[model samples]
Target chain A: MVKRLSVLDANRCTGCQSCMFACSRRFGVGGLAYSAIHVRSVGGIEHGFVVIVCRACPDPPCAKVCPVDALKVRVGGGVILDAAKCIGCGFCAKSCPYGAIFWNERENKPNICVYCGYCAGYCPHEVIALEELG
Target chain B: MDEYLKNILYIDLSRKRFWVEDRGSLFEEYLGGVGVASKILLEECPKNADPLGPENVIVFAVGPLNGLFPLASKTVACFKSPLTKSYGESHAGGRSAIAIRQAGYGAIVIKGASETPVYVAVHGKNIIFRNASALWGLRNSITVGRVLREIEGGAGVRTIMRIGVAGENLVSYASVNTETYRHFGRLGLGAVFGSKKLKAVIVSGKTMISVSNVKRYRELYDKIYTTSIKSSVMKKYHDLGTASNIIPLNTIHALPTKNLRESSFEYAENISGERLAEKYLGRRVACAHCPIACIHLAALREPYVTEPYFYKTTMISYDHELLYALGSMIGVKDTEGVLKLIDEVEKWGVDAMMTGTVLAWMTEAYERGIVGENEILGLKLEWGSVESYTKAIEYIVKGVNEFYKTASKGLDALTSRYGGEEFSLSYGGNGMPGYHTGPGAHLTYLTGARHSHLDSAGYSLDQETLKGKQLSEKEIAEKLYHEESWRQILSSLVVCFFSRGIYTPETVCETLDILGYSFNEVELKRLGEKILSNKNDFKEREGFNMLNQRFPKRIFETPTPFGLLEEKTLYESVKEFYKILKERARNS
Candidate 1:
């Protein structure tokens, strides 16, 4: 079984959003045009950072709310985006509690994580990791 | 593209008017940020403009890669330094780069001095100038940041850049504090700000950037990003940050311990990164878009002596410069004690490096009886004594007495008055950096533009050369000259000198290509040479005479980790380098 992508420990995060950039870069876009994850300060940066990404709920709201069926749950990964099927409804983005789903207006589609674990590889601080859970 | 939005914002506070100028030619020639700022300063800023006068414009610029790339988000401040009176430029990573880029402008040039205290808040397209009489004379930097944050609209997006009391008082080495922790430190741009009567500048912009080739840009960015994160060069910075250098510097006996009187400290380990992480490391933060969060915040959680239920944790950013300055420079052993002093200095908005150097000088003066107990304003000056130093730092900030006044001016002023030029620890009128490595470091500081360690990082080169035996005077001079010349590109790109390996000449050329500019290796070298010459021209026009250059004899007397530096050879080598620079300038 493959694992989902999430930041395991917040303390380890340097608040360097290489993870966000990696996700955006994997989508073949410049800037944070189509990244699904967001890293922000908890309150004051002195307090540290909070990594907000999809938990890949059992009944994924992002997958459920996609009217065009663009977002579908993969066997191991939480939600995968079929760019061709996305109708730019932005419903999946609104439904996600964590606001993990990102919509690029230029492309007019919702960007969801495929749980490829590529971003984890780039995190030198080990803030992000892939772990299999029942 | 709208031309007005892309143009540089020029605000003259003395005249109380603003205008937008088309920098298309300059921007086309050298992209935005450090590149364009330097060119504009050279072109517009008169060679003889008073460093603290309204004629000297303070330029805050952002690059093409600023909001477009992950880690390239850094703002470069260009101004005639009140500290060095040379070509002064300082780069800081925070919301500054992103704010300027998003505000739909490349650079903001602030000229003239206001009649009264004022703060400019740039929110998107609207810029409002507010009277800051109430905010002026604030003791704590955090209070200034907090007040500005509340008053300014964009809580997360906006950056409140406020100068502390040190800047208000026109301390020669005052620094402008941004987002509490990050600073465009060095060269005293803060004093320039103070001279303008401009207390603070808050900026926020949410504008998106456009890429020339989105697909190709992404591919190239990932290639850089993947390798950048995984690069061995980044491992130390990413993991332990620059604070990790303390241990290594201690091992080499070149840590600038006790104002260079001693090369190494017995209490070095107490303030090292390992110990800090164990005792005080709270959390790490990044700049606007950088993924390599190399910033370390020390969590100072202490129980209130009077009220046990009421406790507060103060988070302070720890770096090598700060550690060396506040720790080893004054012989500080207690980590918390050092942090407390550092916090006080930051609250006052002075250059941490200058403050350390000044306090070190004062400590030495006390020991030598150059300054007596009466001159000390009743505060005891002692090494490894935080209480005395803390009071001294306050006195420096307030400019309370003759001692504070002299110290606040800088080491140069203090040394001249107190007859301690031998151990002043200043080069080119600026306070010294933490490099007692070798002659290369000293020469680099002596000759580099702005007299900063970042100009060439000659210490790194010196360390590399130490593997070989017997480096000639000429060899060292030439090496320093060449590296300092090339650093023009690094500052122009506004690239962090730490990532020199990542942004190689090839990568710089390639990155510029994506921005619709093309330059070969030769062209790049020529550009660097031209910028170096331009800087020299500015310095020469400002009455800088290389022949009259003074080297502190104390350095020669003190033995370094390398060896006891020979004064005659060092002085002669510097003269040769100075001659070379002049020849190049004349020919160019």
Candidate 2:
């Protein structure tokens, strides 16, 4: 069984992206310099917001495009990144349909969500939730 | 640090040469954004400088946290305002902060005026003066924004700050629109732009930033973000937007209706946020990195009068202020009517609050028989008559006649000439923001440096005192002083006051720590006081006087949610405020 996190209700999202910022902060960074996820206004903002995060697909394209084998499937059915092996080629970042894989140009690596569920705990709007599927 | 800040960009249309100068020490002491910008204006701008002349400098500045942090997304624009003739500061969120930061510089200083129509474009670090000959006369603000977006690179990353026909025509209360919906909405910054023959300024940058404590910064960033997004405190703003204030205000009988003739509207339900959301809400949007996307857009699906298949549906942004000004203040019952008026005002780039107040003045003028149809350019002006008022607004923007010119100057000129100061509804020459909340709001508008609602948030004090007791004069003055003092710090951090609870004095100190500026709670208070003094200095240099300042008689006429405000009491309250400020200034 692998757990996936999703923003089921966007109206509930304050657009605070505390989750994405938190993930980058959890990596011990000061700003959004290297956050794994991005929250952007969808189609000119009168339309509300869309949270772009990994869907934890069984056919995860991010893992498939990792030429250096830096990304692998974790025990919980989520993707994990071995940062030491990443060449920062941005191939996986380009392959991510959801654009969840963030590139940190300064550190030369790809930042990915590991389903630690750290961000879900901080979402004040209950906009993000982690669920397990068998 | 020294290499990052180069020459301050000086564009003088009167002189026609754009030059750069060095003024870096001011930044180190005052910090960038409001503090440094204020100090610079006071030092450079001469006494009694004609606000609409080539002398007044418009400064656009970004703070240290900008580009480095996701939430550091506010840009502080400082200039001597044509509206207040005092130090004017307006902070806007959008791509403004990011654009300035990415341009690899902290501040831009613009002076002089252009003889012909022009605009400025800054890409990376290079600056170019573009001939805005064709774009100069556009009435629609969004049209100007769209044209700039298409012609320029960095569509999403850049900020297109343009003035509409209102600014081009020197409307005293004109605002500069950026990112389509966001504005430097107060104190006639747009009029200054218009006076300079400058139509617009576009900024875009794509530079990387270095952080000191990457790990700790990330940790704190995550903590703040999660806490903010998940908090129920933001629910009201996110869902219904500021329109949520409509129901509560109406419930309290504080909704200013029909130019303060009534506190609440009978057809308030039709114009309430609850109604707008249910009937016309197209979507909710957020400003650049902010999770509390409080921007609400209404879908105006109207029939095309010419063809059945050619229906026009436009999405227009709405908020509490617009709802109050265009809705209750003007006696508008139809949400669609309110939306149409709001859209038109925004397109023309006039300050919505001032425009509403101006319309309210015209409505009263018609009622009082001060002006007639010939003066009105044949538009039948009436309260709640959106059809006629819409035409009047267009005429005002186009500067159709002498009356339109004065109306465009703001209510002060109209009242001064026409004898309607009693109900003119202006404070320090700026129109009243929703809520005749009480003496705090009135006194703040009367004396606060900017004459802006955000200056001291006096409305908050009124709400607090509403719990069955009127505040003593001394007590009210103290509260206003403390609040305005603290807001100086908030504006320095450029934090949104709406999120004051989460970013308490303690949190503000901690956030400053991340940027290596450590100050205790007490020190933060002192910094705020110093900044307040600096702003007052700018006002004093411009010869701003509290004496002989016009306090609208309309305020006394209209009974508020709290009570009918007495003239003697209000004047006494204002005197008390002035006396305390004078004493404090002398001591400091």
Candidate 3:
């Protein structure tokens, strides 16, 4: 079974950024600095929100663009960054169509979702969920 | 203190310069948010400075707990009010608090006026002042937000507080709109921004915080998160939002109707929270870091005149205050009319409560012949005429005539020129918020530091009075003073009022203690008292005399759950509260 976080319904998102905090909390203290998932308003908040996260594409463009073999394919469809082999070129971040590649400006490294589903637990509105796809 | 909270960002619009100062000592004693802001307002603003002048200061602050705890999500803005011409403070919940905290500052003190229209962007240590002359007289505040959203770098984390046409024209009660659904909604912050030629302040940052004790923090976090979702108070706030209060307040004959001429509306049920939820409730939203998504937006759909299929749906945020002011107070019976009026004010970026109050006073004055068709500038204002009221809202921004211009100044200014002082329902110079419970609400309106219902729960005290335990004036005064003093702690923590019940005195102490701030419940209470007295010091310094407050005659005419209030009782209580405050200032 492969498990990953997904936005069950964008309409249910209140744009509270709770999931962002939760995602960040996994790396350190509760904060938005380390978040991989994001919920931005569609033009304005009155229109609602757009939840952006890595959808775990099987043929990922982010991996294809990487000059060095820094991003290794996971058991499922997502890729995990090997920080030791990686250079801070930012090509992976620029190549993602969903804009899911989050950058750590302080370290100049890309922070991609680990598919841990930690953020799903903190979404108060049940707008997100961890799904098991077999 | 958290090391990040020690930095205070000082921005000078006149020189287009910025600096950072570490005010660690201030955080040690006064804490952050309102406590620090009140003192800063005193220092930066000149004595009795013009509220809309360049000398007036804007202090936006968050507490030590902000960006660290749940529901610690509000940014406190303190300034000299053009509306009240006294100590002014307003709070808003959005990404503002989080952004400011992550930007590595406890407070941002803005002084001096920009000669040209501009919007300030603060990205952590980065600061940019961009020219915004093109955005200056935009018809809708929503459009301004849309424009900023496209150009701004921080998509999810940033908060853009922009004013609209009403603000650009210096409507005294104009609001600072945030996140479309939220606002710093009272006491003329927008007018101050307009006077400075400041269009918007966009703030965003991404910084990691370190925790002292991981397990304890996690345990406490889970407790607060669970309590916020499970508590009945939070449930009500979540389920229907605050509009649920309409039915209950109307049942108790406490809902202000038609400018308080009637305590309850005959068509109360027609526009109640239940009615809106059933018909037009579109979606729910929340401020940053808050679990209780209490903000309810209504989707109103209207067809084009020529084509039935060509329709547009507009999303408008609604709460009890907006409903009371635009619905019952202005005599709009249907939900559609109320939503339309609410939407109209939202577009203009004026304080919805003040705008609604102004419209109500205008309608009453017109009916009484105090102001004729000539004074109102050719429009016939009726009780439920949404069309005419909509026209008046535009006139407030356009300044079509003398009467609409005066209306923009507020009820206090309106009643002075016209002869309807007795019917005007403002306290000090600020317009009255929803709630007509009795003496407690009236006392709160008159005595609260910012003259807001939220300064203390006088409405809660009305429950005691309703139960027939008649409180003495001293008892009433002491109870209110104590409650208000305690709330100073909450505001200093920068916690949302909805989470106050969850953050009890002990819990607050514990939370602070965990953050390396050692304090017992008693010490915390003492700190709360000191912070409150500091606010009063600013109010009194700016010529806000508690002794000079006048009760509107309309309050006595209307009956509430606590029955018709005795003016003498409220007067003595105000006096006793004055004595209590004086004694504290002396002791301090």
Candidate 4:
């Protein structure tokens, strides 16, 4: 069993981008450029926010779409990106159904969630959490 | 130099040319936001420039902490004000700051007037000038935003800033609405946009920002986050939003009602924060980097008149200012009526505070037979009359006649022609804020830069006085000067005023140190003071004289929570404020 970050209840999300900041801060960086998780309004903020994060799929489409075999399926769920092999084509970013894969334009690499669960800790509203999956 | 604060994007609308300049030196000296924008304005904007002409320049700047820190979500917009006719600045909290920072620019300066309508799109390093002839005359800002959103797809990280019919008509008090809910709501930014034939601006970017100290950065981030969530400092703002001030202000007789004829509204309870939360509160949203979700949206559901079983749901954001301006000030008793007027104001892209103040004056003027039915287009203007106010809003946007056209300019222009100068309720050519707290509030309105209540928050001083703290006029003036000077640092950082308690000078210095900018607490204070002085210098250059400001006679007629404000006491306080300003200018 392994724990993964999950969107428990998106309606509780405030679109604060605290989780997004947390994800980037983990890399000793600031701004949303490298964050794996994305939160956007449904239309306007009134309808509430949609928290988009990797669901740790068994057969991740993002991993399969990588031209250079840069992404690999993790043991628990989700995919791990091999930065060395990445070509920066952004195919993996487009292939992710949830739009969870992010592009690091400066480094020319894919920013996929490593299931670190750091972002869940910053969500004040309990909109996201780290949960175990078997 | 910090990677985020590297470049400035300059757009010449008249020549349809755009260029990016290295402004690392400017950011280094001024930090960012108003600090940098003000310097840009002084350098670029001509002296005594017509606010609605090619000479005027619009500068939008975001601070270094914008995309990096929590609650640093404001984008400062600086331009020559059509309303105040002086140094003008407005801040909007939305995705605007983040978008601008990530787009690889510390600031953006728009100059010259376009021959035809256009909308500028800045996506990363690419700047696209699109023909906006079709979108120019759109009735509402929301529609313009939707159209731009459809064409330009940067869903999460993009900010759409557009104007409505009010702006297109060159209304002096028109606002530039951002993200539909937030706005550069004061000092006529939208009129500047209209004058340039610029309809909207879409800013989107994705760029990583690096920090010098990783370990120290994480520690500081955790400390700020813990303080933000655990502390009760932000509880009130998060709970009921700024609308929570309604009950307290009304209770203390600080809430101005019916154009300052009365200090408190009798039906304040019906359109209060408690009532809105209980009955109409739909959702709470936040700006990009802020954890406190202070933006409250009310769910207004209405049925179609012609169709059966068809209903439309509109979400309107409300705050204490809106509640004061459109709700109690106009004598609107019900939350529904307030929401309806707010919705109309948002659609028209007009400043709600100015609109309400003008309408309150008009309602009183009509009652006194100064303005007849001819000016109102046969609509009878009366207090709490939602129908009449709705029609008036339409007329103001349309500019149907001389009265509506003059009113569109602002209270200063309207009252000067229409004979309502006694109760115009304008301070420094800008509509007074919601606070009629006491002398502190009134003095701040008169002398504060931009004539905004948030400049010094004299309402807090009034509250302290109500709690049995008696102070002289000079002491009150000193307190306001101190607060206003310190706020320059916060605005330079582009942080929200709500987080003033969290980000002290020490903490701010620590954060800046981590970001590779070294500054002690003393240096930070000096920087704040210098910024304030520079802004005042700009104002002075543009013909703003503290001694020449006219105190509205109506405010003196009404008694506040403290008592009747005396003319002598106010004059002495203004003189003290002038002394402080002179001392600071000399020191800087």
Q: Say which candidate scores most in TM-score.
A: 4
Error of model 2, residue B141, in angstroms: 1.2
Q: In model 2, which regions exceed 4 Å deviation? A: A1-43, A47-134, B1-25, B65-72, B206-209
Count residue pairs with overlapping backbones in model 4.
1
In the range A22-122, model 2's lDDT, one tens digit per residue, is 56556554345456666655544444567877888777788888898888877645578887888888988899877777666557777777776777775
CA lDDT, every prediction?
Answer: 0.78, 0.77, 0.89, 0.90
Candidate 4 lDDT over B1-588, as tens digits, reads: 577586999999999899999888888888998899999999999998999999999999999888888889999999999998998999998899999998888999999999999999999989999999999888878889888888996788989999998888999999999988999999999999999999999999878788888899899888988898876868888999889899999988889999999989999988888999999999999999899989999999999999999999999999999989998889999889999999999999999999999999999999999989888788878899998899999899889999999999999998889887999999888998999899989988988898999998888878887787777989989989988988989998889999999999989998899888888988888888888888998999998899888799998898899888898899899999989988987887
* Model 2: residue B548 alpha-carbon error in angstroms: 3.0
Candidate maximizing DockQ: 4
User: Candidates ranked by lDDT, best first?
Assistant: 4, 3, 1, 2
Each candidate's DockQ: 0.32, 0.25, 0.74, 0.83
DockQ ranking, high to low: 4, 3, 1, 2
Of 2 and 4, the candidate ranking higher by lDDT: 4
Name the lDDT value of residue A33 in candidate 3: 72
Q: Write the per-residue lDDT of candidate 1 for residues B227-295, one digit (tens) a residue.
A: 777787777776778889888888887788788898788999988988988888877777766767778
Candidate 3 chain B minimal-lDDT segment of 10 residues: B209-218
The DockQ value obtained for model 3 is 0.74
